[model samples]
Target chain A: MKSKITRIIILLSYSFVNLYLIVTKKILKYVHPKIIPIIVISIIIMSIASMILILNIKIENHNKSKKNMYIIFIIPIAMILFIPFKQSECLNTNFTVTQNISIDNKEFESAGKQSISNNDVMNSKEIDINEVIENNKLDEKIKELILENDVIVVTDNNFVKWMDELYENKIYENKEIQITGFAYKESNFSKSEFVIARYIMVCCAAHMAVGGLMCNYMADDIQQDSWYNISGTIKYETYDGETLPIIKVNKAVETETPSVEYVYPY
Target chain B: MYKNKAKNTTLHNLTLIIITLSFGYLLGHLIVYIGFDQVSRTVKIFSTKFTSIIIEALPFLLIGSFISSLLHVFVPIDTLVKIFPENKFTGTLFAVVAGVFVPLCDCAIIPIAMRLIKKEVPVHIAITFMLAAPIVNPISIMSTLFAFSGKTNIAIIRVLFGIIISISVGFLFSLLVKNKEIINDKNYCSHCTINLNNTVWDKINELFLHTSEEFFNIGKYVITGIFISTIFQMMFDSIGLNNISISNNHALLLMLLFAFCISACSNSDAFIARGLMNSFPFGSIIGFLVFGPMLDLKNILVLNKYFKRHVLIIFTITLVLLTYTIVSIAFF
Candidate 1:
């Protein structure tokens, strides 16, 4: 009689889980916000069911193994209880303040540079190194100002517009600046112009977008894939309906390529 | 005899339950106190973003379990013995291919695979199916489409590559581990050995009881996975790791680590991938989504239970390589 009752309980619970699975998927699509509570309830029910099932099964001659599995099962539940709830706190905090600050100004900026050792500024900051170099000449005063302020808000959608505005305003003309990034020689190999590029990642490196700045250098001196710190003044050019910022080379020197090259811009 | 059998089965089950609950509680406490808030937060974010993953996946789990139970209940061992090809090589090939069509996730597939083992299926075939079905199923493909937002080519590439790797690795391992002595024989508990002589109501009651026991056993892990993932997500957002600038390649590394920490299901990993698109390189992002569901922190615990340690290790290494190669080629 006990066995029969156990069997019936199992089957009904199994059926309910299956039904919930099917219904929830559809419900989540039409009304996405309700997914959280539904998921929480589903998880709770599933956990209870799992505990009961684990209790009923017996592995002959494997007491230790069964014990270990039990440990694995309970650990996450305990974590759930002890871990302080922080989701609400996180939602309340403004992520934008950090985003607006340039990578060079983040609280962990110095520590990050120290840990990595290679001072690839392009990979470290929110401002495009190329864009910054082109739009604002790195006069000692300007460089010092940037170092002090230490935040650049660069987004893929706003990059071109920002660059155009910087050029029109002559924000970086004849001011010596330093920019570091990967060197991508334009395929056309124009004698006096080439593109320097860096990857911009938004979430994790999986969905990376590329950002680049045009710089004019003597054909013989440019090397593809070379990492460089170019000190230059900003110049503007128009090509095929797009405005391009040209880093008028004051000085160009190659630097060691950092061991890690692609940087995501959050 | 019946009374003795019932007593032994009951004792075994009760012991198993006690062990599982104790372990679950211990691990949960350790994670919370250990100060790996980064991991905790990633898990939480993943759970919140992909709540539908468990829901979408539960149906497949139930179906797989039902089929396994049915096979256990009705199929005779002698009849099952003749179902495979006479030639080992041909049998393995058939098994690997068939495994691709089944589409069971790692957690649920174990029960089905164990059933097959009992039904006299070659261990090689069972292993192959266990690995292949989770990533190569119709739902996985459809979910990938939703994650990538109509990148049919990426989805196709992932599925094709997934199958090739699983089959090849499964076959190689079959050759390396030829000892069939480890396989368990099919022996139902006295409770499971229902007498047809009983009334219809009795049979129904028996089935329900058996199903609930199995459901509860597995359901705990699912819930744990969801809760851990939810907490991790919250922490990740709070810390603002998403905004850090590291090179595209390094960003991929972080993403892979993050995915492992969160342990999202394969079906929902793509949605997480989509959310992260702006933060990392395309290749690295692909690696995070692909490699994670196959061999992350949580899935590894589940896989460790069924597969030999060496087999699991080899599987993890191969999956990482395959995911990296595919992503590199696609993005480059």
Candidate 2:
């Protein structure tokens, strides 16, 4: 009977977490907004399953291994309670505000240099943004900004497409661009260098990877995980023979957390 | 008894255990070398990743459990045994086709297959269904189509490669495993599978009870798989694994490595694979798409929960080699 109660409690706890996440909209932090419908259906099924489990409380069936199942499930539930409710807060409060030595270790970067050079053959070839944009239906506004705008301001929706266009086409070289994101510095980077990273959440946080342009701002006081807006011109940096964009910033200001935490492209 | 009961003390089992243990330790050291801890960014990332996977996978997992439980209570064993294909080739073909129609994700399919096997379905048919359903499903195909921006070739090629690989793997297994039960279903819990309720209410009760059992059992493995794979992905990312260069054949190998480690769901993996466009060539991208749903880190852990470790290891090796060969040939 005691074991039966524990099982019921565990099942209800599962439903409660789902409800809590949905009620608070914290589910958006972990997964895309599109998945909310699936989540709704899951909670309904679990809730029904729990009620059925309660009515059959006298079944007396679970063995020692059966009880152990509930024990293992407690790990995920407990860990979820500690997660920040908002996606933006997740970066601002929990993640790296400063460069962790492992990520930017000089030896590691140099070791990877050989492979980076291999891509120089591919990256060296010039890509025409105008032609590519006309052929491709994606990235309407941001893709057009390259030839028209004097200073392109990067927003959450166009962040990824803008990055791709800027990387390939030389039109953006030495052009002023304004961007805002969580500040992250690699250890191999000097004090003046850091990446303003934004997570590209395709479906959920599970598929997220750090993406941003490297910025060269001569300042000692940059918070690692906090959001910052930087005004800079796109410049090229060569590593082992392959060249990629690096921002040379004229104005670096610690900004309020961005309204949008992640860029949803797909 | 299950597959392992016959081969308890074999050198093969010992070697597999040692390999698994070392792989785990290697993962641990990688995190520690980077100074990971409770307060570290990696830990937070781990929590987020684990939670997201579970949350995303929950609906499919429950629906799978419900289907499995429904079969357990309502569908008689004799009926189940009757519907199974008589011939090996036809059975494998039928199972792959069933996967395309039913179209459950991997999370949902395992429990359903286990239920079928419990009802005396052929091991190969069930395993084939498990492998093929997630990959060839309409949702997965449509997602692939959308992710690749309606490149019919990418979606078509992926489904073609997936069907070929799983069918071959299934046909091979049917030759080896025959109709022997891979899972030990006897002398266990009195609550589910073995019981056949008469009254409608009693059957419904059995359904819910069995659903609970299947969910909890599968959830444990899912959690463990998520924990290991997420930590592995996070640790590698921290060390800048993706930033490294890939040259020629190495791209295919590395993409396979990424697919194994990353373990994204089949439904959404195309988007992730699409992101790999510039870094690796089309052949390697194809390898990642085909190889992932069949034999990834998460699926391996789930497969280990049922089959013998040696069986999984062998099948994994076979799947890897076949995918590499077929994809290389196709792209060549």
Candidate 3:
């Protein structure tokens, strides 16, 4: 008689959990995009199985071991019930590029021209001469020397989007943008076009999504997956029903690869 | 002799019932105190923490579980025994390879491997299969590929490392724990015996029973692991660990601690690893995947139930060392 009551309680508990999961999944759909389908399916399957198990208990002959099975089932549900004890708000900080620049508006306009006007300023600091030439401000021969020595090239879809956004916002329009990412080129495509790519992960690398920015350059000049820091102007184009953005290369240079190549800014 | 045996059996049965009743009461009390509102909140938190893990791992778990059930229901024990070399050295090799093909996850594999061990499958082979099957199966392989975005090299490295570790550990275990007396002597067909006279129905019953049992066993582990991990996640959120500089490789350290505490199943660890990647490293993430399936809090409890203390100690040490080595080499 004691065992019969225990069995009924176990069955009811299991049924409640199964019903709870189904309802919870429905509630979660508004909060998280990916989990709704998985939750609904899991609840349905678990509920059906629990119902079958409960019905089986009713017909099966009295067995002492059935109690043990109920114990196993309850432990997990009990553990799950402990989740609210630790629930708290997640901290979210938005680090924007506009926040990084400390320079006043007066200093910004003069800094670029002053650096360009003085020969001492030009010679003392590392400046890409090719950029001056590309902007039609310097000689082509000086630009060639600059292109031959120092410039980093990035070619990946995500990097391209990042660069496009950075350019559209005028964050690095007249200034230098230093980027480190992988180099990729599609075969049978244009020889002058390549991409710098990096994988963006949300939680673990398992859900890592690839992002890169496109760069127009000779394929022979850049190796795949090579790290680079290119200083260039960002440009935009439209292709295949999407607006495309890219960096117009003034100079390209190779650099030592970082030990950890992937970086998720978010 | 029959009377004495019956008396001992009755005593054991009574003890088991008492344990179950006490555990059930504790569980009922926990549910009631937490109340329906809190219960729903906990479930929501747990489901969120584990949703990604389950999504990433479910396909592999299903495939691996199905394959394992198929092997159990269809393959003859003698046929499996014949495939391996009789010598321990070569037998361990066959064991590791067999582990890769078997679909059983960490917890469910224990019973199936024990069954194989009783049927004259070499102890080393069974041990290797038991250790490696959860980490090296086709479903795990597919999930890893999809998780890493077809990074074939990393997937290959994981499989190779798993094989090497499982084989070596299996061989070591066979030498250390040679006593047959330590193994469970219960009938493999205890649950299936009721419908045995009808072969077709019996086979169907066995398959259904085995699958259901396997699902419940592993599912419980997953649910528990997810709950603990969620708590940890909440703690991390409260402390503002998410905003910390993960780029410095400290994310791996945090995830290792999290994996140890949560003790998630290997098949589902990838999803947890995925969510963690935003804060951890590829190497430390792999460590969680390799180690959690082999040695976790829940599996440890299950292990303690069957294996002697001394054997469990050796197994735990070897598994931890191998996991550390494999993950270090891959990430460092």
**Top candidate (DockQ):** 2
Candidate 1: Cα lDDT at A212 = 52
Per-residue lDDT of model 2, residues B185-276, tens digit only: 43223455355547888787777877877777677667666666666666555654435676757878887887887677887777666645
Comparing 1 and 2 by lDDT, which wins? 2
Among all windows of 10 consecutive residues in model 1 chain A, the one with the lowest summed lDDT is A109-118
lDDT of 2 at B41: 46
List where candidate 1 sits over 4 angstroms from the true fold.
A1-266, B1-63, B78-106, B179-209, B239-255, B308-318, B321-332
- With a 3 Å backbone cut-off (N, CA, C), the pairs that clash in candidate 2 are A97-A224, A97-A225, A98-A224, A104-A188
Give the range of the ten consecutive residues with the poorest summed lDDT in model 1 chain B. Answer: B181-190
lDDT of each: 0.49, 0.68, 0.49
Docking level for model 1: incorrect
Model 3 TM-score is: 0.51
Give residue B130's error in model 2 in angstroms. Answer: 1.8
- Best model per TM-score: 2
lDDT, candidate 1, B1-332, per-residue tens: 58645754664575456446534644564576676654454434333233334443344455555566556655665565587776766766676567657755556676677667656677667766766676777756766764443235456656665666566666666666653543311223224444547765545444434444444344445544544544454345446564677886677668777877666556556555554554456667657655665566546644444455566676677666655565566555
